[model samples]
Target: MSATRLTVGWVPLTDVAVLIAAAERGFAAREGLDLVPVREASWANTRDKLVFGHFDAAHMLAPLAVATTLGLGHVALPLVAPFMFNLGGNAVTVSRPLAAALAAHGGLTGDLADAGAALGAVARERLAAGQGPLTFAAVFPFSTHAYQLRLLFLAAGLDPERDVRLVVVPPPFMVDALRRGLVDGFCVGSPWNSVAVDQGVGTILLLGNAIVPRAPEKVLAVPAERAQAPEIAALIRALAAAAAWCATPENRADLAALLAEPRHLDAPAEVVRRTLDGALVIDGAGTVRSDPDFLLLGANRPEPRQADWLADAMVAAGHLPQDAGNAARAVFRADLYDAALAARTRG
Candidate 1:
């Protein structure tokens, strides 16, 4: 019999490794699933397409699921994330010009406090000079990337709304935007940050973990109505297998190769390696870090807290109401996760 084909949407980030791993490692095949990984433009597009039924499920931003569940984005079709794909693959990178200004003020290597203070000084100088407000980019308005960026600015006593301009730029064009001076800085996921540093168009300001430790990244999100399907269960199980394999240090190189597929990132294997290995790259400085910090699609990876935290982020960002906790939990689908973990443990 032919395998059941399922379409899974994903943005072009290194953290979406579970979807790629399941496809490349034959785990999906073993589960009798033909997973067609659809590449999306932006988080908003991914969420909209998934809600409209253009996608069966997606590698979604955690906040988008909570927002959709609360009808914040219009049409509250509940969605659930049974597994987290990965974590801590994001960074805040400033354009070369902005980096130069910050460097001139002090340097990029300063701790988070100093970095924010330097940027604030720059923002003030620009304001006094009667120049336009400095603009920054984030992947989505409701994403952790955005909120984290805002929090970082706030921690430095810079008002995100008044001192700097925050806009949504597609991840693929972040480097180009920096090169063209369209934006001063961006908070985006890996490969893009590595790509920017490699191209010499941008400099890394801080890692996502530096801003917020143990941050939730991507998740295997599905519409709540579709969670009843046996195929969805199988996909979650296959994701578990792929996550188990990916969590092994021996599989790191192989996982990097899969991410380097021409149709996917097509970035250098070394860049992908650093991303998977959680090494910090500052102006192309490759320093090995012990954290790796990636939350693969696994039972141990704080999947429930991922939901709670994401929902809280959505509420914080004004995408969802704070009282929608019950509704948010309904969409996180811990039962599906429990089932997937049981199967993984049994076999």
Candidate 2:
């Protein structure tokens, strides 16, 4: 007589689209599901809640899932993602003061490599002048945001750990943190970077796609046993359809409306619109860059190759002791996606 109720967790970010659309647009309802999305303050909160059984699934950072399963940053709990929600929707932003410094030191080049090289030069100069390493924040220790930031520094021949202080800051608070001088720069998913630019607190450095194009972003993550639930297929299908809807240009306005709900991203539809369209306003003065593949949804799947890539980066960044190959493959669960989608096709 009643729809199946399932509680899930998500942070306030642009990539939470599929989940919100699935629930709000009746996709979850058609699947006989009453999806309850619980808002979380941070990725750590989402991970902890999932482990504590407070969530049936979570819109989670891809690497956080692998990290949890591999015991890299949390208690070992093998999670699986049958569906990846989106890919490559992140950016690096620096405070106005730091942006000015970087610009003055030739760090504002549009090229990722040239920019990083110039930033490395500035970092060296600041350190020699006793300013030491600049502080940079990411949403999670084990997220693509972190790895992408490190890779940007790596390309410049500057060690991320030595040239900058890495820290964790929640997405909703990134702009304020940068404004307050808590962090000099941050690598975060949309539309937080847009929010910072809109607020005039930070200047966009580079989109994450410049560092790792098509980098895996969020996934629909659940514990190992939950992956086997019969309802997972319908749920994932609904989300996949929702992702397709979000990817449509005609639906951008509506999609932005869905995400701009008071309890969801809670930001301006215009800002959300820019992020969805990849027409990013890189600075407060309104410079725009059109990046069509800034975020991939719709046909996005949980690829083990993505997991393996992130795992290798984690090890290289000294976040993991070993390769975590097996753990990554297990958690990625492309097999589950194949099975679920196949069953849906058969039906």
Candidate 3:
């Protein structure tokens, strides 16, 4: 019999490692699946393509999945996440001038609260001096990155809505946006932040974990109606196997090289490697910050609490109404994940 072919959409980021590994390392083939991973430039494109049936599944933002299922921003499409791609793989980067301004205020201080206070001070100074608010970019409105930024602002005693401006910039375009002075800073996933740092246009202000420790970042989201399909189960099994492979420290170097291919992230292997290892280059001055929990990828099954957490965050950020109910929490199909892995073991 021929292998089952499935098209999966993804944005170019280190968290897409599992999907890339499954396609490149023969894990999908082992399960009679031919996984075609399509690289997208932005989270919106990925979500739209997936919802429009251009993709069988997608590497999607956890909050976006929740929001989509709840029919918040776009058309109400039932989406379900059976597998989690990763946790905590994002950072905040500020333009060189913004970094200087932050330093003058009080410095980063390696503390999120202290850093937020300093940022609030700078934003206030800018406003008091008749300057516009500092604009920050995030990948998408319904993303952890945006929520993290909100948390940073709240920590600094500033209103995310009124004190500063937040805009959506495609991850790949963040470096250019910073360099061109279109944005003062941005919160984005790996390789992009490193890319900005490498170009000497930005300095890393804080890792995503600093704002929300071990927050669920991306997931393998499929149409809710197709959640029970045999192919989806097989794909889940393949992804589980691939994610385990990606978690092994010995396999990361090869994985990083694979992710750096033109068809994937099309970034430098060293930068991808650094991101996978949680040893990121933060600035042009060669400041390397290492955090083992920076980006975790390994057999992460979707859980209901994670969905609830995202929904709560959406409400907190005013993206979702308080009466939105808990329907979104059902979008995470942990039962499907459990069954798929169990079937794999039985086989």
Candidate 4:
């Protein structure tokens, strides 16, 4: 078969499992595709490459596709996410001193509500003490990490904008930023948080699942015109197959090793294994917490509910206009996912 050629842009996080596997495993070949998975330096670079024809599709954050549709951060190019790669794979990590402070002040816990309420109290104390608000970093203005942290603060009655400052720090530099006190805490996707904790410079406070269970994280995104192409289905099926392989217990170590290659995440295999198994090593003492369903790389479906919630969060955060809800639905392309997966199931 003459395979269709396509290039995909991706960052080096574990969430790029689908893209990596599709190309590295036999999935892409089986799908009649010459899939070139390109590693990008940053999310912005990934987005720009996808938007500027450098890539045919991308391993993209779900919220970034919605925000791109509404022209929130960059050019108003309508992107479509026909398959969500996975869900629930982000974490909020804070500097050890900050974590210690929160713990000492009756705020630190595994429970989201209890931890959030505790953090809210700490935020108030920082303000009262004439110290600047604690800084929190997210990868981008339109990322799930930002949304997760925002939701955590909102639920606890803390104003995310006023009580604490939110900043943008690329995932690779997140640990360094925290270590240097450039940011007190950060919400970033896996591998990075594990790296931070492994380095003993940071402590993970909450997993994204704890904040909002099964919240959409990454997706397979392309320009709207390509969403319905026949190859789109092939690629979707390939990605779904890759994700299924990645979720298997025996493949976890292999996945970590593949991801730890120099061009990929470049982190320790042990750290990547922890994330794959949903067992986070939280502190310098190597305390591991088993978090069930950390990464939802299950049946391939992009739920509109997630797009709606993300759009609503964007609106609430003043990143998008009121009409963003409508844009999110158009951008998410749940129907396309159904069409592709259903066709694959029939075959």
Q: Which candidate achieves the best lDDT against the true structure?
A: 3
lDDT of 4: 0.85
Question: Per-residue lDDT of 1-347 in model 2, one digit per residue for the tens?
Answer: 58888888999999899899999988888777888989998999999999989899999998888888777756888899899999889999999888888788677765688678777888888899998798899998888999988888887778876778899998899999999999999999999999999988999999888888899889888999878887787788778778888888999999998898788989999999999998999887789977898877775677768878877887887776684566677788778878877876887
Clashes of each: 0, 0, 0, 0
Candidate 3 residue 60 C-alpha distance from true site, Å: 0.6
Using lDDT as the measure, what is the rank order of every candidate, best first?
3, 2, 4, 1
**Per-residue lDDT of 29 in model 3:** 97
With candidate 3 superimposed using the best TM-score fit, by how many Å does residue 138's alpha carbon deviate from the native? 0.7
* Cα TM-score of candidate 3: 0.98
What lDDT tens digits, residue by residue, belong to model 1 across residues 146-170? Answer: 9888877886677877888999998
Error of 3 at 294 (Å): 0.2
Could you estimate the TM-score for every candidate? 0.92, 0.97, 0.98, 0.96
Query: On residues 144-243, what C-alpha lDDT tens digit does candidate 3 reach at each position?
Result: 9999999998988888999899999999899999999999999999989999999889999998888898888999999999999999999999999999
For model 3, the stretches where C-alpha displacement exceeds 4 angstroms are none
| Better-scoring candidate (TM-score), 1 or 2 | 2
What lDDT does each candidate get?
0.79, 0.86, 0.90, 0.85
RMSD values, in order shown: 2.2, 1.3, 1.1, 1.5
lDDT of 3 at 63: 89
Model 1 spans > 4 angstroms off: 105-107, 284-291, 294-302, 344-347
- Deviation from native of the Cα of residue 338 in model 2, angstroms: 2.1
Please give the lDDT score at residue 189 for candidate 4. 91
